[model samples]
Target chain A: MMPVGNLVGMVVRNTVRSPRHFALSAFGIVIGIASFVFFLGLSMGVRNVILGKIFPLEVVEVVAPRASFMGKDITKKLDDGTVEMIRARPEVKEATPRMKVAFPAAGFGMFEGQEIKFEVGGFCDGVDPKVLADDPKLAALFKDWEAAGADDPAKTVACVPPVVDDKGVAGKNPCPDPEFYYCDVQDNRCHRRVPVIVSPTLLELYNGQVASTHGLPVIGDLEQFVVERGGLARMRFTIALGETMVAGSAMATSDKKRRVEGMLIGITPKAMPIGMTVPIEYTRRWNQEFAGDEAASTYSSIVVTLNDKDRLAVFSAWLQEQDLRLEDQLGERFATAIFIVTTLFVLISFTIVTISSINIAHNFFMQVSERRREIGVLRAVGATRTDVKLIILGEAALIGVIGGLLGVGIAFAGAALVDWASATYLPRFPFKPPTYFDFKGWIIAGGLGFSTVFCVVGGYLPARKAAKLPPAQALAAQ
Target chain B: MSEAVIKLRDVKKSYGSGAARTPVLRGVSFEVARGELIALVGQSGSGKSTLLNIIGGLDTADAGDVEVLGHDIRKIGEKELAGLRNSSIGFVFQAFNLLDHLTCLGNVTLPASFTPGAKDVEARGLEALRRVGLVELAQRHPSELSGGQKQRVAIARALFGAPKLLLCDEPTGSLDSETGREVIEFFRELNEKDQMTLVIVTHERRVSSVARRIIAIRDGQLVDGEELALGAPGDAGGAGAGGPA
Candidate 1:
């Protein structure tokens, strides 16, 4: 019986003694493992961003009852009454209504002598601020999130009216704090800018459609565009107070158009595609003045933020009972496509790794043939059959470790390169993930473990062949 | 009354199968008492090496019992045979099978490393080199050593584990006349000074002359014991045994 320590020493010494042999055996594994890690990083990045960041983990979207190609005529509008009713449900923590409107108005102007202008016309949304402000947990979602604020001084707190007595502070409601964009909702008086929660979809649409058509340099993820490119710079725009209008287009009366400076506050999740979310009260005021007897009392959609993810199915079931439909942005077509591509990527990765293992086995067999005399010498000295087998397997394990580490390095470098390219050249890509790769520790470990196990298994048969040789015959081989 | 240190009975060995099968050993038999200096003399393919392999536990006999250091080769498992080989027998080949990658000391220590619970391998290796007068060349690799020095290193490795039996196959077959003579003298010294039990296979007359007993093999069978006899100069100072005490 060979001492285990001596066997280990011999294994290491013999393996390290032949540098060329070691490297050749490990190279195949390195290529295989690197491809596995690289492709996996890509698939995982797309899955997380599409399923996690964009769609979010919990919150579900409920669109109003409307005519659809499916021909399901459920006449329950997602109005304020629906929002209240949904909010009253046990599974629903808070329900926020989202109203869609065309870009109120967009034009370029000089603010502090900096030229700024809206380059595209996107949709907008009117939202009541109470959703985030009242629910601490929901507000917590936007706590650290921020958009590139317009540097216009008028949009700041300078126009904030002082706190008034209970009788009312001059106006029924002044801008609630510095975060509020406007005040004096009773008469639509001018005060600061309008606080708005802009959805990330607006940036995606502009970058994808408007920027490409105009041949402009594309913007990266929302944060980079907002912070580095000053995306919200042109917050001051005048929209027609009438029902239908465009910035440069005409309205029934020019006087009907009102001027308001809008300030971007936070970002809305992509699952809720409502454009820019503004104060619903201000939007109601405009609607009352223009729509005569029919102001939009029902909302375009309601977003139900769940208290617990476990209750999402319950809330979804209840929404169905109320004749509402939960809209999934990731439709069946997109889901099936992702599933097929992801499956293909995984199959390709496993095949490469398995083939590499077989290659490792072939290499070991050749090594055994070349080292037959050496194995005989070891046996002649005193090595048992098990010792010879251990030495061979130990060498294979070392190869696996070296290949695994190299694979991780290659994966990281490739990911970083892809991320840099995405930030610089491919920013308009539909999946606007904050970073193109997420190098989770467990994923890297799995890659390492898989390669090692395959290598050991691959080397087994050759090791046994070497070990079974009779010492006298083996000694005569050379 | 006691058994011999090494024994073989009707050991038969063949290579290949059926029509192509070539018999290498045919019912050959021998015994070596403790401390015997023996020479197994035969031409190449005369089965002397095959008999030595069976005695050393490196090869199994197809039909026979081979006992070395009280362990029956036919009855034991590979692990037990390996242990017997490790603890009781050491081999010196004509090629001086010293691993080129290892220093003289490393090659000498190799056998001890295979023995479980072996400790102070360097100390024991140095001691063996000291006995063989190659302590100064302990750090030199086989490639850098002279033929005589490499044989000395091989001898040192065989003696390192304090093996009970030293088996050499044409140990001087590759050396020149002068080097070969020196290796033979070294073997004589080990046998006489340490009372070491030795079984050497060789065709060289000079090598067999130093042995107390010479067994001639021909065509896988032992030559008649009476002609050459088990003991040469049987009256020469207890022959193989040291003076009484």
Candidate 2:
């Protein structure tokens, strides 16, 4: 057996001397590894957008089973009790009750200096403030204003209204705490606006579809627009409680109609898909005012956040026993589609690497044949058969390392080019990612490891043959 | 008499099997004393090289007792045989067998690579090159050197381990006569001054003339008198003495 240093020296010298012989072989490895890296990166990037942004898998929405015909209830009601029960499970990180506005409502708001009116029926829901706890900025702004004395007429103070000059331009309002309180012109009273959060999907829809069609300026970053920018960009809106566009849809009479101020806080995936989400306390108070105590307490749905997604099956089974079902069937289907597509791409890459390894084997066999006399000479100089084998394998390993690094680099460059093309040439669309490839560290390392193992495997048979060569016969060869 | 460095009794070897079997060394017996410089002279296909390979532990005898440097060649395992070949026997081949990719010094130190914990390999290689009077060409690759320089480098490599015996199989076969004469004189110097047991196998009378005694082989068997008078330089009378038995 040769010393490791001596073996490495010989292997390096031989490989460096005859690089052309291994170039073609290394090219095959590079192509195989590059394809593996590129395809895997693309898959991961698309999956991140789909599963992470559009339909997050971390939280599952649980809803009561639909009522049977003949006005009979079919399952247990989704309420605070159900939320508590769900939260008690070990897999449940959190279970927050969500309530839709039980009464008809209409919202009129000044967005970027333009007055806009929209119906809030079936679109608005309320969630616990704890949902935004992970984001301190959002959590700080989104809270129950009524619980903080906004609903008490005696607690309210006189507002310092904005001064209007002769040209009808209003100056900044003199309210001291403008972030949470606003000066209502009708009542001349400072009131805290109901803080609300909207889903990222809703923002994507508004920017990608609605804003473009309506010629309205799209909100770029919701947090920056609502929190960072001051004055009219603060997104103050008024909701006419108990009064909707459809006159007969109001559950309460005209005398019960009341207007409440609302403020846009930030965007979150946990928000309701199509509308603004406010604190559960606001919805409870309004539900009790316009409908009944039962409507106030009963939730529309419960969003269950799971600590371990691997135990989701068990959680889902428990939900079934509680007469509820997960509302993420579409997300599950999308995840399955992504998995199958990624697996197919990986299998295709594996096949390419396997074929390339065979090519490596063929090249090594030819090299061994050409260097028979050299092997014989080494054997004559006291090199064991194992030494000959190791020298050959070591050369193959060097080729693998070089080819693997080049392959990874090429894949990264290819991804950057694709991302540049997407950003430069492609039109904006809903959920379109900024980049289409995610080159994670493990993926690059795996590509290199895969190349080296395959190359070594390819060299095994040829190395064995070289090691088994008869020294006498090899020396006597012409 | 000096102790026998190499002892072989009734050594037999053959190639192939069945009707295709051809015996290369049949019942050949010989002893080479320590520090003795001898030659085995034979024509092509006369098995002189085969006998030398067995003596150097590069090949095994079909049925016989063979010993080199006090170790039984037939009884040792492949690893032990490789160790014996690496440390106890030095082989100088006709083709020089210098790796073209390596420098002259690199080729000289090739055998030392197999010795675990062996230090100062380059220095020892340089010393061996100095002995061969090619120290200045240590950095030159084998392809850059002339045929005679390459042969001297191969000899330096053969002497790297300071082995107990040196085996030469037509060592001067590839050189001009003058270069061949120089290599032969170097072999004589190694034997006389260094007391290295040397065995030179050759068909050329000039190469054999430098040896103290000659053993001629014919048709896989030694001649009646294994030891012959040392042939004088340029002697051509017994050039074809062992042809076809």
Candidate 3:
């Protein structure tokens, strides 16, 4: 066998001598690798938007099962005790209890001096502040402001109450800082505006569908809107307690409705899919005041975060035993569909690569036939059969490296083009990603490795054929 | 005689299968002493080239006790045979088989690549080119050189390993008579000054004329001159004889 350096030198020299042949032989590999990279990147990007935004996989929502008509009595209320029990389980990282505002409510907000009113009857939930811990800014702003003022009276700011007329209408006596304080009409007292969070999915839906349809300006950047633009102060709204637009007078607890202010703090995946989420203390207070103490203490559902998502099956089984069920079956179905599509794309890429390798084999066989005399000359000068084989395989590996790099570059260019086209021409849709492809480091490395391995595999038989050629016969070959 | 560098006894080789088989070398035997220059003269199909290939460890004999530099050619594995060929024997062919892509120096240094830890390979290659009087043309590719220059480059490559024996198969077959004569003279000079052992397999009279002894073959069997040269008791049959000088 020859020294590795010399062998490599010879292989490079031989390979470079015929660039046209190398390019033709490597074309199949380039196409195969490009397709492979493009498909994998696209799948990853789509999966990110689907799983990360539309239906997150980190936490599973567990709710009490409905009672059966046969009176099986399997329905267990989700409460503080149940939350503690779930949190104590080894598989559960956290169990955050969420309660729906049992009383009727409606919100009217002013944004840029334009009034927007919406019913909050089925669109409001309350959760613990710890649910927003992943985002420091959100966590800081989403605390129970009522509890904070109660804990320290110094945190409270005094405000004048709005004067009410005999017709059940009130004159505005807005608090100096509506973000943190509200003039409550019922108690004639100042209270903090309930810090609320909305889901990122809601923002996406509004931007992609609602805002476009209504010719409203979309919330372009979440960070800028929530942090840099005075956060909650920019989106202050009044929530009328014990009243709702859906059932006007019938659902009201009294003829005179109590009004408190609410503010949008931040958006997060932990928030309700189509609702405003406030700190649990505020909901508990409101539920107790308008409904009953039982409504305040019992939770509507619990969000269970797992330490390892792989242990979801065990956790789900435990939930089933507790007469609870996971509420995100749509997420599972989406995941399965995405997985099947990704696998099919991968299989098609693999088939292209496999066929390309056969092309490489055919090209190498022709090269060997053409270079019979060259092989004989090398053998005559002291190269062994193994040396010849190494030289040929080395050339194949070089071609693979070149082809792999080119393929990946082309895939990136293709992705950029697709993203550009989507941004420039395609209509906006919910959960549409900024780019349609994600070229992770592993995918690039795997693409290069896959190309090189297949090329070497293709060259093996031809290399063996070259090695087996008798030096004398090879020399005599024309 | 000086210790034999190559010894062959009852060597036999054939081509093709049973019914179609044609014998190429039949019970042929000879010894080449160290530092001796000899020629094996035969017609195209008489198997002189095949005999040379067997001696060089490039081809296996069907039956034989063949030894070169004291290593049994038949008993050793392919790797050992390759090592023997790489270090102890050199081959020169009629086509001046230089890799066309490489320069003269590159072609000459090709053999050193297979010899591990071969120090000063480039310097040694230059020296080999110097010995062949082609040092000035070291950077020239084979396609740019004359037929005689290419053959000299081939010779330089063959001498790169400083092999004990040089085997030439029609080394001047592609050259003009004048250039062929010059190459033959260079071989004679190498034999005389460097004490290099050489086996020339050729049908040309000029190549045979320069050798110290000539062994003629007919119908795949050695004729008279080899028996006389080896001092074996045998009848002097029809042969092309050229005894020591």
Residue A1 displacement in candidate 2 (angstroms): 2.8
Query: Which candidate number has the best DockQ?
Result: 3
- Recovered fraction of real interface contacts per model: 0.74, 0.69, 0.76
**Model 1 residue B129 lDDT?**
96
lDDT per residue, candidate 2, A1-478, as tens digits? 7889988888889899998877978988999899999999998898789878887777789988776767876556787678888889999998899999988888987676677888875678989999888999888778776586444452367876688799656677556676567677668887677887888899989999989888887788765565545743367788888778776663535567777778777788879989889998999899898888988999999998889766788989987887788985666778889989989988988898889899999999999998988988888888888998999999988888888999899999999999999999998888889888888999999999999998999889999999999788777766
Candidate 3 lDDT at A339 equals 90
Error of 2 at B14 (Å): 1.7
Error of 2 at A349 (Å): 1.0
User: Candidate 2 on B127-232: residue-level lDDT in tens?
Assistant: 9999999999999999899999999999999999998899999999999999999999999899879999999999998877777668888988888736574523
lDDT of 3 by residue, B1-245 (tens): 67888888889999999899999999888888888888888889898999999999878899979999999999988778778878888889999989988999999998887888889989999999999999999999999999999999999999999988999999999999999999999888888788899999999988877776777787778875253342211324423223331
Per-residue CA lDDT of model 1 for A12-51, tens digit only, reads: 8887888887787777778777777887777777767765
> How would you encode candidate 3's per-residue C-alpha lDDT over A1-478 as one tens digit per residue?
6788888888899889999879877999999899999999998898888877787776789998778657675467788889999999999989999999887889997765467888885688999988777888778778886674354242344556777799645577566654567677556567767788888889988898878777777887766765655765677788888778775456665764577788887778889999899998888998898878988998989998889877888989988888788986677788889999989988988898899899999999999999999998878877889999999999988889889999999999999999999999998787777897888999999999999999999999999999999988888899
Where in model 2 is the C-alpha error above 4 Å?
A148-154, A158-179, A182-189, A226-229, A246-255, B229-245
The reply for model 3, stretches above 4 Å from the true place, is A70-74, A148-159, A164-178, A222-231, A248-257, B224-245
Per-prediction interface RMSD in Å: 1.2, 1.0, 1.2
TM-scores of chain A across the candidates, in order, are: 0.68, 0.91, 0.91
